[model samples]
Target: MILVTGATGQLGTAVIQHLLRKVPASQIAAFVRDDSKAANLLKQGVAIHVGHYDDTDSLDRAMKGIETVLLIAGTDEENRVHQHQNVVDAARKAGIHRIAYTSRALKDPTTLVNRLMEGHVHTEQYIKASGLSYTLFQNILYMEAIPQFVGGEAVFERGIHLAAGQGRVALALRSEMGEAIANALASPSEGNLTYQLTGRESYSFYDVAASLTKLSGKIVTYTPAEPATFIAQLMGRGLPQLLAQRITGFVTDIANGQEDIISPDLEELLGRKPTPLNEGLTLLYKL
Candidate 1:
């Protein structure tokens, strides 16, 4: 059976939904920290295993009889890498022959100023050295996150204000990525592989503004602000200083063309063309 960690989150839930289309619910299991959040999965006949990343015993019990485990990247910024290592160790002890992990897709991980990238990098390195066959899906920025990055739907009226400048990202829809991931999971890989899951075309915030203007029937504009000003504005709105800084770093990375990396890997996995930015934006933003 295939076990998917972080099964309650958006991406994990998407994976589960698509996996159910490709395989029987009996063949899929959800490793979740809270069984309460998994009532839907259980109703769908998905076996639920209660466990947390930090809890090795729980992980071991969950890994029992599991042939493959999809290690959804964790959110614990401070201890995520350590927690990921714990899962990897437990998987090894459980004698699982193969594993899969979701990681960030960047041309050069070193150039990142975002602190979260550190966990992805370390986890990848550790997973490689673990002696288990692995499939790494280095996912790109999700189109669903555009709202948070551009100050929400109000940005359609407030105008797009960010430090991203003309930086482009090959952003793909989160649901499409989940479909591709489920496809990969349904047919497990025999050898180690890494797929840079990104859109075939790249787009900038300017493109986003134009698309919004066209789709919403509202005049939307993009105003690139200085990095410091953007960060200060976010902090002024009550975001923690560190979080504000992290967000700024990501946009700045985009400005520097870090997320511009595009690949056919996503489409290849999906068995069809990935959704275009304009179409995805229209679906995500009703107004």
Candidate 2:
């Protein structure tokens, strides 16, 4: 059986949906914190295994007879590394053959996202140390994050305000990332591989603005802000201080052109072009 953790989450749900196309629902298990949250999936015939990253016994029980396990990163801002360790230990005890993990595109310990990604990197190391066949899906920023740029509440009203000066980001659609994960889970390759997944092309903040303007026929503007001022704006707009600071720092990193590069690995894995910026914008506009 293929077990998916965090199955109720966005990425996890997408992964399970893609898996259903290649594997029977009976062969799939969802390890979720809240069983009620996955009632729809259970109704669809997937086995529901109640569990949380903090509960080792739950993880061990859920992992039983599971050949492949996908460990979707938890959303906990603090103590995630330890939480991931719990899942890793349980998987090791269950004797799972292959494991897949979702990690960030670029995880530098010094960056704002480092706290978020440190757990992923640590879990990767733990999986490797456990001697299980493993694959690390290092996914880039999702095109879906564009909505975050617009400020969730005022998105349709004020348009997107980004401080990513001239930096170009290679954004991949979330579904594409899910497809890549499904491919890895279906066919376990020899040795551990870290796939740096990105879109077919890179785009600057201005490019994203232009795409939005063309797709929505709405006047969208990209505004650059200093780190301190950006953080204040986000906080004023109802974002928590911690999250606002992290978002500002990530945008600063992008503005510095730190994540402008692109790779063909995503297309190679899915055998299709990654969704373009305009297409993603148009889809979001409709939503």
Candidate 3:
């Protein structure tokens, strides 16, 4: 049986939805921290097992009779590695053979400025050392979250403002990545494999501006900012200090061309080209 952790989140929900299309609900289980949040999964007839990354006993219970576990990376950047290790240890005790983790698609996961990337690097290493067969889906930036990054309704009024100078980022829809993950879970593998699930094409902030302009027909331009200025502006708008810093770091990473690589593995798995940036933006903005 396949068990998916973080089953209540958006990506997890999408993955489970796709999994249901390919397999019976009886063959899939959801490992959630709050069974209350997984009412939909329960209604869909999925086996719901309550668990948390930090709770070994709960994880052990969740892993009962589960052959494969999709270990969704935790959001707590500071304590996530330790939490993932806890799950790994419990999985070993439960005799689970295979694990699939969702990690970022970076050329060097260690060199990034993002604390989240560091956690992923450590977790990946820990999983590799655990002796269980693994699949790592190094996911790229999700196109669906463009509104959150660029500003949702405000972009129409203020255009796109960021510190991402001219670097390119390959984008994929969150649902598509979920589908790819489900596909990986459905197929068993003998050796550890890592797939960089990125968009077929890459785009820069300039490209984003142009797409918005074309879609809105109202001259949406991109204003580049220094990281310090960007952080200050975000803080001025009432964002938390750590959050402001993290958002700025993402722009800086993109400016340095750290996330520009394109990969075909995602499209190869889906048997279709992933959604393009412009098309996705048009749909998002209702242009």
Candidate 4:
């Protein structure tokens, strides 16, 4: 059986849904904190195991009949390293032959592309030394995050305002990433592998503005501000100073062209071209 951690969250839920389409519900198990939250999956005949990452015993017990585990990255950014380590240890102790991880697509796997990639980087190292065959999906930024970067309605109203200058990202949709991951899990593998999941091409914020203009028939613009100015503006909107600075740091990484690489792995796994930026933007903005 396959056990997927964080099965109630967005990415995990997507993974479970796609997995069910390929494999029987009996072959899939969901690791969730609240069984009630997973009522639908349980009703569909999927076994739900209630467990927390901090609880090693519970995690170990959840692995009883599981042959493979997908260690979906935890949301607790501060404690994720420790929590992920617990899951990895339990998977190793449970004698699972293979494991899969949702990692970030980095320009350099050995270095941090940004602060957010820290936990994934450390976890990847731990998994590699665990003597277990692994599949790491180094996913790029989700297209869904565009609305968050440049507001939803505000993007059309005030256009794009970011410190990320002309840096580009080959952003793919989360659902497609989940589909490719499910495809990988269903297929047999003999050795460890890492797939850099990204869209076919890169697009800058200016391109996003252009796409919006073309799709919505409304003129949009992109304003590339200095990192300090953007942080100050975010703080002026009432965000805390530290939070504002941290947000700026992410944009700063983008400005450095940290996410500009376009790889073929995503299309390879999907057996078709991933969604293009313009189409993704249209669906994202409902334009």
Candidate 5:
């Protein structure tokens, strides 16, 4: 059986939906923290396994009879490493042969976003040490984040921001990530393969702004801000100090163009180009 953790979440739900199309419901199990939150998945015939990353016993029980597992990284910034460690340890105890982990696009520890990804790196190291076959899906920024631009939630609000300005970001549709995850689960690849998953093209904040303006017929602008001011603004929005700082660091990295680059890896895996920014914008606008 294929087990998916965090099935109640956006990416997890999408993955489960894609998997249902290719595999029988009985062959799939969704590991959700709350059973009540998974009523729809249960009604769809998916086996509901109640568990949380912090509960090893629950994880062990849920992982029983499972062969392949998708470890969707938890969103909690603090204590995330420990949470993932709990899942990894339980998966090892359960003797699951293959594991796929969701990770960031780049693993460079020096980058600001890498601070957020440190847990992933540690978890990956543990997974490799456990001797289970593994696949790491290093996904790029989601196109869904673009909506935050219109509301000044992200980097576009301030007049200037710090980043590797010339760098590029290869964004991707979250749905395409689902397709890729399904493919990985259905057919486990030989050895440890890390796919730098992304959309078909790369774009700057200016490009993103142009796409948004075209789609919304509104004049949205990109204004970069210094890290301190950016963090202050995020804190003003009620974000915790540490998280706000991390977000500031990530946006700075993006502005510097550290994450800007497109790879055919996603298209090659899914056998089709990922949805572009304009198309994603149109879909979001219509919704």
Candidate 6:
């Protein structure tokens, strides 16, 4: 059986759905923190194993009879690494033969300026040293999150204003990444393997501006600003200081070319081209 942690979240849910198409529901198990939130998975006949990253006993219980574990990266930035370690230890103790982890796409994990990237790098190292058969999915920035990076409704109201400067991002949809994860789990292999899942092409904010203009038939433009200025703008809009800093860091990472990755692994897995930027944006924004 395959156990998926964080199964109630968006990426995890998508992965489970794709896995169901390839395997029977009885063969899939969801490791969720709350059973109440997993009503849909229960209705779909998936086994719900309640667990949390902080609770090793719960993780142990969740891993029972599971041969493969899909360790979805956690979101709590401050304690993410420790939480991921908890899962890793539990998976090792459970004697899981195969493990797949979701990590960010970075050319060099050690040199990245972003805190989120740093956490993922630490987790990846821990998993690699655990000696379990593993697949490292170095996922690129999701096109669906373009709205968050580019500013959801605010972009339409103002413009494509960001601190990203002239940086480009090779963004692919989360759904495609989910499908790839499911495919990886289907074929278990020995030794540690890494796949850089990215989009076919990279795009700058100017490209995003152009797409928005074409889709909305309006004269929208991208205005790059200093990181401090962008953070000030976000704060002025009533966003929390910590949140503003975190958001601006993504733009900083992009400007440093950390997110400008273009690879064929995603397309190879799907046996089709990964969704294009304009198409992803149109579908995401309904424009």
**Candidate 4 lDDT, tens digit per residue, 42-66?**
9999999998999998998999988
RMSD of 1: 1.0
lDDT of 3 by residue, 1-287 (tens): 99999999989998999999889999999989888999999999899999789888899898999999999988778898999999888888889989889988876655676656678888899999999989999998899888988888788789888998888899889999999889878876768999999999999878888888888788878889899999999999999999999888877888877788788889987889988988899888788
**Per-residue accuracy of model 5 over 1-287 as CA lDDT, tens digit each:** 99999999999998999999889999999999899999999999999999798888899999899998899999886788888888888888899888889987763555555366577778788888888889888888888766653353333333223332445678888888988888778885688878888888887777766776776666656565666777787789799998777777777677655567567888987987788878887786562
Residue 266 Cα positional deviation in candidate 3, in Å, after optimal superposition: 0.4
lDDT of each: 0.92, 0.81, 0.88, 0.90, 0.79, 0.89
Clashing residue pairs for model 6: none
TM-score list, all predictions: 0.98, 0.92, 0.97, 0.97, 0.90, 0.97
Which one wins by lDDT: 1 or 4?
1
Give the per-residue lDDT of model 2 (tens digit) for 1-287. 89999999889998899888888899899999888899999998999999788888888899899988888888885877788888878888889887888987763545543255566667777878888888888888898887767665365467667767787889989988998888778775778788888988889877876777776666767777777887888899799998887887778778866567677889988988888888887787673
lDDT of model 1, residue 276: 95
Error of 5 at 164 (Å): 7.9
Cα-based lDDT at residue 171, candidate 5: 81
CA error at residue 80 for candidate 3, angstroms: 0.8
Candidate 6, 1-287: lDDT as tens digits: 99999999999999999999999999999999889999999999999988799999999998889899999999888998999999999999999988889999986565665677798889989998998888889999888988887678678778888888898889899999999888878765757788889999999999999998898888778999999999999999899999889888877888888888888899988888999988998899988
Clashes of each: 0, 0, 0, 0, 12, 0
Q: Which candidate wins on lDDT?
A: 1
Candidate 5 accuracy as lDDT = 0.79
Candidate 1 Cα outliers beyond 4 Å, as residue runs: none
